[model samples]
Target: MIEVSKGIYWVGAIDWEIRDFHGYATPKGTTYNAYLIVDEKVALVDTVKEPFRDELLSRVGEIVDPAKIDYVIVNHLERDHFGSFAQVMDVAKNAKVYASGRGKKGIEEVYGERWDVTAVKTGDTLGLGKRTLRFVETPMLHWPDSMFTYVEPDRVLISSDAFGQHVAGSQRFDREADPHALMEDAKTYYANILMPFGTLIQGLLAKVPSLNLAPEIIAPDHGLIWTKPGTIIDAYGRWSKFEARDKVVIAYDTMWESTGKMAHLIARGAIDGGVEVKLFHLRKSPYSEAVTEIQDAKAFIIGSPTLNNGLFPTVGGFLYYLKGLKPKHKIATAFGSYGWMGGAVKEIVARLKEMELELAEPALDLRYPVTKQQEQECIEFGRKIAKQVKEAKQ
Candidate 1:
């Protein structure tokens, strides 16, 4: 945890979660987040999970007298929110804990320890000396315990997890590092981390707009703080809308590299036309993650050499995942390295149809040991997509 602003600091844990990169079904390296405050009356916004309770306390101790902290506001009750709850109060005995009415119930379930917890509803306001914090109940903004706390005067939004990336580090603000990687991480965070609550997210977007609240800085519980504000808010709005990128996502599962050759050719063409592309070898990529990469691509293309009388088994899995996502504003095509058994291309095309992807004209399917003509066809396919990309942009 590090301080990013005067009287403000990040108390979140770096994701050292084992296999975090692989994902949740597997061992997920997750960021256990928390925050601290130093106002006229010191307060701590949230606490880390239990394993880092002591660390949370020490961080809070860095600025002021923990005992003098007037409040410990609980944002959400996933142990991540209150794992350090007890230890924090152990140090700040006289502090008042604030949370939503339902959020308080959650805190109590594990709060077995005694403490002063005040439950407030929407529109509740807390006076923290020179600054005022407004609590906005954002139920199901991913979780029931979820809420958005806005600190007026400073124009800071202490959002727990929202607009946050699953970044692992002690860097408190984004300006300190590379913006591109962090932004991608933030996008992946939205697509994968917050995927399940789309409707609620849309509602939050509508509601927050009515508040006319645009923070100059958005301080989330995880990842770097947004000192430049709209950089992340704009991103959140675009991502939540499932905006499509003018790029192609190439997913392929090749039996003997023939289908892979076709995929490479198509990618070259798309790149030549200035369409960005992400190539994921299905055998080497997880279906769940591939779906994420495909989420916003302007086009999706899959290739699989015939196997078991149909598309490769992995290609089928990827298709199923894509179908569940029901992506929008995308074109789809099928290509493959087929031998005597050329059914894979047809099967993939049919599956893509089931996913509701608008078909791009003339799906390409190549036979084993492509001749010069086949490679040229691949380049043509790329060039076609590139043209479409530019036309779409226009």
Candidate 2:
């Protein structure tokens, strides 16, 4: 186990083989992080997933006997963070289990009454000799039972999932990770898991200072521990506000080559209009990646061929995921080619409207193979959206 501070250690497990978390692709895998704080009465902050329970015990065992742990604090009840709760309770038999009220109920519902679990709320403090850990309820910052534990003197915030990435490696601190790689994973994590909780995050950030919880280190349940918490806190602030770069994303799926041509032509138009563009083929690109792009870009330009009088499956599925993620303050437009029916463009527009993104340009629904005029129109449509995005930026 690595010592994170004077008396605290990292006793977590790293999963180097995990390629996907639930449905979101985690090509870089992740870490199920838990902390071990040794004071007069030792406290264990969270636990790893079921499969990594052994790893966690091994790390903790290197420092102190598992049986010596006095309190086991659960910040979240999500399976990844608490799947090994049973094993922990069994090993640390004398330790008092603590969780948020909702977290306690959820844990009991999932695992039954095998262990004594105490419910805690915001402002609750658990004293351990010279050190004290304060709980801050952050419900729906991703999950209803989510919370954060602040360790005083050391100034460490054991953030459940917030400020986490999906990077699995020996580098335990954000200072050790590649800035670009860390940011990419962070953005993907936020887009896939926490984007829906933007409003809650904003509220939480505003209240942090008033609560007097300025952490020097942010130890999340996954990925690298943020040694410089201010960097991540600033990032969260900007992302929660739904800030965007001056760029356009042309996401599409083509039945033949017609819609594909339109996507490229539109991308060219956006470039000529002086804004950056990202063209993604839905079939070739993963939704996780596309969502990351949507998280930053100012405009969304979609193209999809009609199938069964509706959007193509790939495009339709993407819209569903995007809508759930709730990316905001973007301008959107649609384009597509059709044979017998031309509902793809219209359906795409409807989905964009549901997301509440501004309509930057008119839809460009065309016939079978894009003609010269339609190609030109696609370019003009791109240019129109680019201009709109630029204007929004100003």
TM-score of each model, paired residue for residue: 0.79, 0.98
- Give one clash count per candidate, in the order shown: 3, 0
**Clash pairs detected, candidate 1:** 17-29, 20-29, 269-382
C-alpha lDDT of residue 85 in model 1: 77
Candidate 1 per-residue lDDT, tens place, 71-185, comes to: 8888887676677778778778888889988888887777553777788887788988887788888777767878878877777788887887766664667798599978877
Error in Å for residue 39 of model 2: 0.8
Worst-scoring 10-residue span by lDDT in model 1: 20-29
Q: For candidate 2, give the lDDT of residue 339.
A: 89
240, model 1: CA deviation in Å?
A: 3.4
- Candidate 2 per-residue lDDT over residues 1-394, each given as its tens digit: 5888889999999999999898798999999999999999999999999999999999999999999999999999888988898898899998898899998999789878777888998999999888999999999877899999999878899999999998889999988888888888888999899998889999999999787898989999999998888888888888888888999988899989899999999999999999988889999988888888888888888889998899999999999988999888888889999989579989999999988878865789998998888888988988888888888952
Q: Residue 117 CA error for candidate 2 (Å)? A: 1.5
- Residue 303, candidate 1: C-alpha displacement in angstroms: 2.6
